[model samples]
Target: MGLLDGILGQVAGNPEIANLAERIGLSPEQVTAAIAALGAAHTQPGDTVAGAADSTGLSPDVLQQILTHLGGEGALGRLGALLGGAEGADGSGGLGSMLGGLFGKA
Candidate 1:
């Protein structure tokens, strides 16, 4: 799998990110960059989506759509938990929870 495939796999199922990117007319690179920016924002406390839009030159609406497609609020929680090394209720560091931690939701 590609780098994005691996990274995004933490937030979504395989091929889901690719499908969302295609639907939103964004390159996989752009999407990946935005996701990275979002993760950074979680730590730095900046405008996560806006920073991504600025960097990727994608409209905020498009980025919002991508986030929504990825499961929105629940997705963010998962990302935060994942990044923060917080264990899920099952006592394992599941991908979604790990990602939630990354986004500072944990």
Candidate 2:
């Protein structure tokens, strides 16, 4: 799995895809595919969950639930950090502002 996929897997509150899948009523493979789609969508220019739903054929609500389970904006911050916009020494930088805009948290 790639970094984003690994982070998604971890952020869903479990590293075991099967466990999260079972809870969400999807197979592990489905969950994995959805996670991958979510990661891809995150890099695109719009609503991440909605975009993932469009590509993955899952509903936005389901994707949002998964996102919420994965720590929501907090997870986005971590993802941004991993992507290299490390909030800087003063904790103000690309990641924070960019993620804030992404989630309307600004």
Candidate 3:
């Protein structure tokens, strides 16, 4: 699917994400902008979640909400826990999954 389509899908599937944006006072266009910004990024292989937040137009808090809703409470949490379950890996972190620095200087 195209980028825009994928984004709409993300928001549609997750009401929390939609509510978070609404509560944050983000306009539909701003939400679109945020998602588009994220989509255009290409995070490095070792980049931390914070680092990706900096590159995207959206803030870390906003990003967290998006991520939380993207995979739903159950899936991403389980995914995060499963990934964090590895020995020596620090717990209490986000999903190890990377979506690339989609908003690469665009």
Candidate 4:
């Protein structure tokens, strides 16, 4: 795990959430609510911001900006995995598959 491994592990009450809210010009409550909705909807963590944009009426551009600010290249790197393109270290699918295993997708 990397530095963000510990950080990303803490979603609720994470100060970054509030920072993201401020950066996106939204209330922290709104950000959390959107995150919750997306989580329940089975949206990939990497895509949560984009999916939340649709549900919360936030612009995709702003959401992307928020993600970039929060994760930098690490976040960008996850996209391929989230989209089921990048292979995991074990060479058994990618992050999408890993998340599917967690959520019982298939």
Overlapping backbone residue pairs in candidate 4 total: 0
Strongest candidate by lDDT: 2
Better by TM-score, candidate 3 or 1: 1
Using TM-score as the measure, the top candidate is: 1
Each candidate's clash count: 20, 0, 10, 0
Which structure is stronger by TM-score: 3 or 4?
4
lDDT of each: 0.60, 0.63, 0.44, 0.51
What digit string (tens of lDDT, one per residue) describes model 3 on residues 8-105?
Answer: 45443444445656877776555544544443332234433355477665677776555544443334333333333432456322222212111111
For residue 102, give model 3's deviation from the true position in Å: 17
Q: Which stretches of candidate 4 lie over 4 Å from their true place?
A: 1-12, 34-51, 72-106
Taking the tens digit of each residue's C-alpha lDDT, what string does model 1 give over 30-99? 6666666555554455666677677677788887776666566456556655555555677575554454
In model 2, the runs with Cα more than 4 Å from the true position are 1-15, 80-106
Q: Residue 55: error of model 4 in Å?
A: 2.5
Per-residue alpha-carbon lDDT of model 4 for 1-106, expressed as tens digits? 3422322344435565677778778776666555444443333555665666767786767655655553433443443344443566775665445334323355
lDDT of model 3, residue 75 = 41
lDDT of 4: 0.51
TM-score of each: 0.58, 0.57, 0.38, 0.39
Q: Write the per-residue lDDT of candidate 2 for residues 16-71, one digit (tens) a residue.
A: 55666787888767776776677668778998988899999988887786677556
